[model samples]
Target: MPSRSAAGVDRRTFLRYTSAIGVTTAITTGLTACGGPASNGDGAKGSGGSGAGTIEAGLSYALSTGFDPMITSGATPYAANMHIFEGLVDLDPATLVARPTLATEMPKKINATTYRATLRKGATFHDGSAVTAEDVVFSFERVLDPKNASLMAQFVPFIDTVKAVDTGTVEFKLKSPFALFPSRISVVRIVPKKIVEKDVKGFDAEPVGSGPYKFVSAVREDKIVMTKHDKYNGPHPAKAQKMVWRLMSDPSARVSALKSGRVQAIEDVPYIDVKGITGENKVESVQSFGLLFLMFNCKDERFEDKRVRQALHYALDTEKIIETALLGNAAPATGYVPATHPDYRKASTVYSHDLAKAKKLLAEAGAKDLSFTLMLTDTGWVKDVAPLIKESWAAIGVDATLDIAKSAAQYAKVDKGDFHALAAPGDPSVFGNDVDLLMRWFYYGFWPEKRYGWAGSAAYKKTKSLLDQAAGLTDEAKRKELWGQVTDLVADEAALYPVLHRKLPTGWTTDALTGFKPLPTTGLSFIDVGRA
Candidate 1:
């Protein structure tokens, strides 16, 4: 396996690749808890558990990225960062609905273009610094700075400026009236200004936030150690004394750890093993908005025509792939957004599995014998589904070879415009749930502009204008109407579209862990959850 520089990949690409690294570990590690609070400068050590107060979880992701809320991109780091940091308004771990965390409540809409947030008075960072309006302003400013190249900035283009109105009040003036402004605040988390100002790089390496847990250390491909932040005074306090997230990327290792009592909970449980795990160990497959999407290199002359893209989608037997490869843990994508979402709308051009239509379309497009490399991530589920896809394409006279690698390496090729088509799993629901934010993630920003090569097209420009116009409108029904139009255009274009929306399977000990719920998003959350 070759290594690639992770310099330019976006958050979605970063996390997708992060979850794909399945490094196998033979032994489970125990957390060594700190007796008392540790300063932010000196790293805190985690404590061990006896399946009582302290909790251990086997995560299927490795920490390939940093921990800065503004920039951290990998799956594990993002999950851990959720416990270590918080935003003015944070999404509920189980249900991705935006709620208050650092703020007393969700940001209040003062006017059409302005919103106000009041910080909780007693909240403090892991470093023991007060969470103030200045810190909130600094957090947003750092992300908004172009020189920093923060991945979060793209999601918050509505903010014109963030100013401290008082000690506890922070005001946001938007570039325009963004209807999604309240929920969108979750995108940029609040950070302590002094710690980050001292050394931004150090803060990225050892993040200090006001969440339930404080970061202790992160050993790549091994384990990330965290202890309860004793000083944290907030709504969601740490329920367990310590949490040791063992990075057992291999599926068998995770199940083994869970069964052997080395871990109380485990994420990304294999579909095959779900029925086998019994008694004290409980397994569940919760429906999620996460998906495996097919994106084409529109710049490639072979895929320049819309007909070829649609032909490729039609060629795949999605229903069969869902049943066989996913073991009935997923639903075939009916539209741009999944049906589980609140704003789900069926697209006008839905691709049902049709091999005959695919062959006809291929012949019409003058591509009777087409051959292309289908790039994919090394995620356990994705590898299982990759062959099924190849076989489906083969049935339609398409020679599709697999280019399987860690997500970072595969995306390196995608980023450089060196790949023809890609099929990979992604979870953008972590950032937001609205149709506009979800659509804009791939179609509006750097993704379309750089990676997919569709920004220059007239269709792409029209989609952008429609999204912009919709964002300004205060009417909810009219906004969705415009969003439906964008979905129709993208689905018909087929440059990038979903194959299926999957159910995230997570297994945990019913007796050992309490209040632990499976999340619809990629990462795990332990807020308000405890060990039995």
Candidate 2:
């Protein structure tokens, strides 16, 4: 195991990474939740549930967690706060539409270097301050600041600058002819300029937003409570006055809470619990964009060889992970980057579970007694399946020690390139349907640390060159043509690999809530809910 800088990503791999690609620009609307027959609302009025008064929902996330979305990292916890915070625009889960939130509509493209956006009418922050062009510009600037340590900064730094032109409009300038601007806008979740200015420390204290819900109170590590803001000016009615977000850490405990009627909703249901519940016996079965995978550190000397990489790829059993580990709730996949996104590349130059090929490649590479520490963290999927993988690899003469990292340590390790191989999940956005992000993350020669997995591969230089050519091609036909070639090259040589994947599932008692659609990326949509 070596750091990204220590692993040798040569110039060749860098060229290939730059020239490689897959592009996606849009997302899908989520699933719909209709009240169930076992519903607790008891036809109260909406959903036949008595009436919408106070909705008590249980989230596996602890409250009092910091307001830093990028810091939190994981999909479940990040999504909990995402429900309350909003940005310049919002993705409508039902229609796969991007609607104006703080801003009224899409930004106007001025030229290859700049674009301008018009603000929405009468949008105000929860703190009584009017949200205007200034706030939008400030929000983007804050995230881009290196000191802020926003994980989002890695993606947004491409833009040269963001500025306000007038009262209702703002402008953005990019260094190059970047086209995925809208997709980037979708993730830069807006924060109130007033709140951060007042006290950066108190940001977690009910940060103001124009969303339908307002932060009420929260206890660190336990739960966060949000009440419906009366001043919310949206098309829908917010049924529940108080949204009690309970932070239950245990997955089984979350299930128990749902069964006992303690919490109305929970996300990230362990795949093991899916069959016992859902009943098909009438609860809504939520199929989300939940993607799970094993990450290889190309920074490691052992993984530098392409044959070794391919051998490792073919040794695992994805179908078994889906059936035995996930129980048919997910799809066995290979590189569904920007998972479930509308424009992601589907036809793979890189998908095969060929064990024989894997064995042959290992022998060819002279990788005798191949072994490394395979780091995994505690979770339903990993806990159940990491052992199976260890055994699978062992049978293939590759010994792997299952080293599990604690939550905090795990986050630190991956971000710092501290391990050889680890199990990590990525819910990434590709503002453009092209492969800039795909290539930069996996194959960039200059930033081995940034290249998702191939940071230390010997072929990095060549990969980066290919990526530059792919990105520079403004011609649509040739760009796609070059992208196809890039895809073929990486499918054979790169380090980013997908193991087993499952659909993210959320549990909600139909009695107290309505309009709960589960998104693949984020956990739940708060604005869409109403007193049912």
Candidate 3:
């Protein structure tokens, strides 16, 4: 996005009008509370139960899910869990390039279908076994083993086999051609084969890895304490052991915690609270590419009409949503894919607010009594955006209904085609527009063969074949060409609609935090977290 002209950070007329009414436009609130950290949410008290060297941080989700990298990796917003694990390649601070963490170098492609990788000799797991090729092979294989239930396994289905050629060397034989294989291997965090072989539940509770930080202790759904791994490889970490993670479920509670110095680095700063929350001296907010969208179930007869879908798009007041709901931190969306992705058509036309045009389209389709069910989780972010959508559709005479999938049933509902429209937090792509990324979340029959309510209908069946064909080809230009073809077709069909790319915002309390960067997975990790 730095290469393209960044748009509209300044206040707008609508924003000015909203400010007159006293509202937060994904705005920020001043946080000037100064003191040692305290625990705000319900969790085990003290920095650590033992009151040892621990750096305290706050997160949006409870720490019930522990440090099993493969369990909830990128596909979910569990960067905090990933913070406890180290992958083969870590995101470089200056370049944003994938650099080696466990492996010696970028994976070397022996041919169109095979890659050879070598392990970093001195790297050791916390249990002190030299990290070997076998561990890397086991981790990758286990994730793709179907029963492991890894959410981010779709990218590497072609991985036919992973054999440790030697203690330090391994081979990955793919079933098809993949030019971006190295990028795929970069994020798979290595686990000790010995530990997982014994207890899956125990490993999930307390896992060990060769990351910059080592896990100290964790109380399920409450908080986690991590210390700097003194034997960490790569650039010596600036932080010395002392990091604590407190789980704050409510956005306002997270804000209050930051104000009270109860925790450092809170996640999911509501757009309304971005400016005022980060206004504090210690808090710094980073606005990276966030993807948010309202998915249309292709199976539903109501949304199957292109005119009906287009009409819904025409009804939105995107600017107002940003001003009132998101505050001012988010940009309006037009494309189904993220605007920041490499292949995104930056100059493409945007779907601006047009009430008249929406009415006309609906009339043309004889879509007089437009009605649909949009289901989302019961979270603050969903509460803010979904109601705004319902009201916007109502203004155009569309009888839209808002539904809440009970917290426990939400994931199952979305993963299956059980709901009409659901909010999806798609994983961030390093290569940006890899075909797999787009084809998986949308389109008919999602990637890794999960049927999470894709646009499944007669119209989408044709599109899916073309998409599959594109994935099989290795020609870069040809691949880009196919991606454009599918995206254009989807847009022309109005098969999907984007709300806005969801952003993860956090504020730090103590300057003790370092090596913390905005990650693709919007969770906090301790790889670089430490007391100053």
On lDDT, the leading prediction is 1
Candidate ranking (TM-score, best to worst): 1, 2, 3
RMSD of 3: 10.7
lDDT of all predictions: 0.81, 0.57, 0.58
Q: CA lDDT of 473 in candidate 2?
A: 54
Task: Single out the weakest 10-residue window by summed lDDT for candidate 1.
Answer: 22-31
Candidate 2 lDDT over 345-437, as tens digits, reads 543645467778888988998889888888776554666778778876776789998887544456456656677777644434212123565
Q: Candidate 2 regions off by >4 Å? A: 1-52, 63-65, 68-77, 93-97, 234-239, 278-289, 338-341, 346-351, 411-418, 429-447, 450-453, 456-486
Across residues 465-493, which tens digit of lDDT does each residue of candidate 3 receive?
A: 77677767778788777777766666667
Candidate closer to the true structure by lDDT (higher is better), 1 or 3: 1
Q: What is the C-alpha RMSD of each candidate to the true structure, in Å?
A: 5.2, 8.8, 10.7
lDDT of 1 by residue, 203-236 (tens): 7677788898987766778888787888888888
Residue 131's lDDT in candidate 2: 73
The collision pairs in model 1 are 31-47, 32-46, 32-47, 33-46, 33-47
TM per prediction: 0.91, 0.81, 0.80
Q: How accurate is candidate 2 locally (lDDT)?
A: 0.57
Stretches off by above 4 angstroms in model 1 are 1-52
